[model samples]
Target chain A: MSTTAIPTNTKWWNGGRSPFNASYGKVMMWYFLMSDAFTFGAFLISYATLRFSLNDWVDANHVFNAFPFFGHQDLPLAFVSLMTFILIFSSVTMVLAVHEGHKMNRKGVENYMILTILGGIAFLSCQAWEWTHLLTGEHFALTKSGAIEMLNTTVSHNPWGHRISGEVLTNALRHTSPDVLRSMILEHNHSATLASLKDLNANELISKIDLNEVYVGRSGPAAFGSYFFGITGFHGFHVFSGVVINIVMLAKTRLGHFEQRGHYEMIEKAGLYWHFVDLVWVFVFLCFYLI
Target chain B: MSDNVMTAAELHMPHDTSAGTGRIWKIFRLLSVITIIELALGFGLARHWYGEPELHHTAILFVKGTMCILSLAKAFYIVSVFMHLGDEIRNLMMTIVVPLCLFIWFITAFLWDGNSWKNLKNTNAGSKPDQTEQVVPAVIEKGAKE
Candidate 1:
């Protein structure tokens, strides 16, 4: 209890004490995060390895250019930057919650925990919209026969390929079938129904599509879609589980469970997991979206 | 012998309450600024504002390198401050930090092998064709039939 330093000669690690000078639960939580780090590290590294091996890959700018409600504005990285801010803000709220826990302020902890949960859900919602946009959105890709076809990005498919232009674009347009051309035109001129566009021949349909407006691309590296979905899906899964853990912790806090125990270490542990989720997103954002 | 049992006082040692909310908000601001800078660089690269024609590739690489370093800085703040790892004893911090060093070699070996594979494939094939060159056109041609 004295302010004076302990004797230098005293044995610091003579057993029967936490050599780390931390609680058992906290120590274990750190180790758990460490292992989880390795798991994510491996996934991201493999993704990089694949990326490096490929000569050409899908551009993040081309793929993630859509913004919700903005309607095909070509705002690259805009939505993802919003998602990153949501996660970061939620991380702030979480740290505030833990700070409140340190002060034994139950009301503060509850308020911040709710905010953090909302943040997590918002991030997940952004991710869902991104996946839906990628899967459902039609893109123009050059087929093997030099015809252009409309395609969506899938785990096995990557519609975002090298840009096709000039003579290649003209030739691909000529080879494209009437039906595919009709559908491709309908994508741009949505006022025309499939039935109305159905009557037009491939040549007329090609005329209907403004060559300047048509962004024709070929298939990119197949592994691009797989890694995008796989890594982000895995990260989204973690955020889902973290939100669940935070909810349980909130319920326990409201019920005065930690109050009874005289410590809110459970909240602290949950905060660790939440922060780890945010940490992983930083790398995920860097890998998938930025570099 | 007395240290064998963790005293109640030791288990729940008092924290410096006076450090206050100032530090938390400061860190929050720091993280936000870092992210904003990263986004700005990303936008610049995407818009082709940063790289000149001849030096474009290296310029883009420089921007990416800066972003990576910024991301690592953000990660450090989240771990150290938000998770309160900075306040923990050095021994505990070392336990967490030391194992992470393995990632350096892990990344290097994997990426080196991947690049080597690319070179091997290119050399064996006599010309390096994109992976999609072999499979996608054929698949699309078949799909067109359906």
Candidate 2:
């Protein structure tokens, strides 16, 4: 009977030096994705923690709404459903590109990669528009509930929501209301016209309104807007950078660099990054749109 | 080779990453449709069409649990076949899925604990623990306060 000696060298390449011998770029990308997944998981988990901990947080619908042209109504989280489908579609295309890469099909890989990139750009643009809407104060309502009676009414506010633009506001107020009109308008103004009250931007004509009466965008405490802006803004930055990278990759593909390489590693790498974006949006959509 | 373009068939797929992504894709498609059905069922329950919020809540709990599991199945298909994580060592797959599971589990516990604590503080919402003081025990006499 002979005893076998244990081999000392085990790594595919000592510390993964030989990229080809090792898992190549794809496997390495998976490792990065794992760690990145953890980061996103932490953020999403933290969001869940914070959201659950809060006693008086804004309901998702009250916070997010459809586009300006989409009936201007407080739409449910349906738009996010569309966004999710788009991302999943992109991910599928990316997977197809990876499959093609293995077969050494450059043009086919390029076609799918282009489609995936387009999908990514569309998702990011949607996110950007969403963030801008939240930041610039659109499609949100001010709901008030009397603590003692549980009597709730949404005093339609938002200084920006006024159909009366600056020109219109100035025109409407051109003739100060008579004693009765002034009092009625003043009461309605104090009660209803909310965004006007919290005048962060002095540019708007309503900045002329009394400061104490207006609180920026109806929800209690400024933490509402702060968290909304902070998280979505951060995600927007990711999308922006992702777009820049995708654009470069797209241009490189158009120049036939991937054709020479006989592999779609560039496309695959970009796909991984695009998937990360999609994953982040899932969390964002769940938190910001759903419960 | 530079001039030779990749074929559409090759791009659609050439290698079998796992059992069959085609089959897997079809399964996922079925799963997604089922999920949509579950979602509607959940909504139906929520609307009290089946009667009683408690019953509805319990139904939703199972429904949502099913949805979550089905979603994981989708991920498994993608990772195992598409990403070939399944082809990796069994231990490696566990390395990914297990940790993710533990994370979700612990977070669920934390959320429940936090909710209970909030309800405790409020003296409203869900039921609270005993507020009455405990009576001093007549010593067991075994140790005499030792």
Candidate 3:
């Protein structure tokens, strides 16, 4: 391979021809990511719309919490928290891989690439756990936008979730006070049951009740789950694609192409994609789980 | 093929090396700290426990948005230094950043339209009960049941 092509003589100077180089690959990836971000953004915005439109049904805390371990009480999203950390850690490793790629250290880049792939898998597993936990409980009963009208139907086709026990939700419901909840909804000195609570004022309804609403929709355990599962699931799909891309890059790393080129833009491009995944998770955590 | 002696300008060996652990590491560490703080904010906000200092919706939104802006910074850093995106011709940087910034604003606008004060107004409108235009039969059922 003669390193003889001068900058002026290269096909890039000709302007109209396709070089089929790494620049095109990276640009295409960026374009694809930008479009995908828009899609995710649309879903999230729609969620916020439906959530606010909801009269009585938005309960961020109770809906998204994890099944607590060992203490006989269910946890509050500890699993998702772990998922977030894992993703960020993976991003860190990805940056390191790019760094090593620059140094033409094929072995180091390959190792870190494998590590990033494993981290992505770990995050996906945690998400799988989170999804199953949400599907089984609470979403069967639909609530009106103003938090009134509990319709009778579970959201999922399966009655039982894969990870969480129905008993946990049953216990939560058992512990919840429909009486106090009712009182919270009723105006001062007014007695209104949850049954007769239709056409209740939506804003005043949530404003009056201090306690958290139970799981989100009759469609699912919480409304957050809809956003949670949808947004996180989509992002997870991106992570999966990234892993596949990395596997290809890893194969290239083994073949000594990266060393020959003496630049790790391919790996760096993958980092951009990976970082985007981590970035989206941050938003999901803040919007769906935190607030 | 014309046999020609190509100039050394042809030898484009990129100065790729272990330029990894310096400033970029520092920036990544900063990002990690921000993320940790974000987690703390999340946990703090999750509980509605009394005396825990409840934050307003605007406040929470600002804090959360800050995390996103930090990511934009990280993206710039990665592209500029790692991908050499910043070293491009002037039109190129504008081509990337300007539209991206516009998209951010666009995302923010739609989010607000669907979820912000406008949404608040919608909820208020939908939730307002028609006491003046009462559900008389429902009241009858209530009175009768009583």
Evaluate model 2 with DockQ and give the value. 0.09
State residue A31's C-alpha deviation in candidate 3, in Å: 2.2
* Best-performing candidate as measured by lDDT: 1
Error of 1 at B110 (Å): 1.5
Give the alpha carbon lDDT tens digit for every residue of A1-291 in model 2: 001222446453343233122134555676677877677666666655654543434544445546646855656455555566776677777777776666666676778778877877777777776655655542212223311111121222222111122332333333322322223234427553444334333233333544343222222323445555666667767667766777787678778787775555666567666666655664565455543
Q: What is the DockQ of candidate 1?
A: 0.38
- Which model is ahead, 1 or 2, in terms of lDDT? 1
- Evaluate model 3: give its TM-score: 0.64
If the candidates were sorted by their lDDT against the true structure, best first, what order would they fall in? 1, 3, 2
Ranking by TM-score: 1, 3, 2
Task: List the TM-score for candidate 1's chain B.
Answer: 0.75
Native-to-model Cα distance after best TM-score fit, residue A32 in candidate 3, in Å? 2.2
DockQ scores of all models, one per candidate: 0.38, 0.09, 0.16
Clashing pairs in 1: none
Better DockQ candidate (2, 3): 3
lDDT by residue (tens digit), candidate 3, A66-185: 553533255565666778779877877887787777566789999999999999888888777667655543232322122323332223232111112244333333333354345445
- Per-residue lDDT for A169 in model 3? 32
Estimate TM-scores for all models. Answer: 0.90, 0.61, 0.64
Give the higher-DockQ candidate: 1 or 2.
1
Model 2 lDDT, residue B18, Cα = 34
Local error of candidate 1 at A123, Å?
Answer: 1.1
Listed for every candidate in order, the interface RMSD values in angstroms are: 6.5, 13.9, 9.8
Q: How does each model score on lDDT? A: 0.82, 0.50, 0.56
Using DockQ, give the best candidate's number: 1
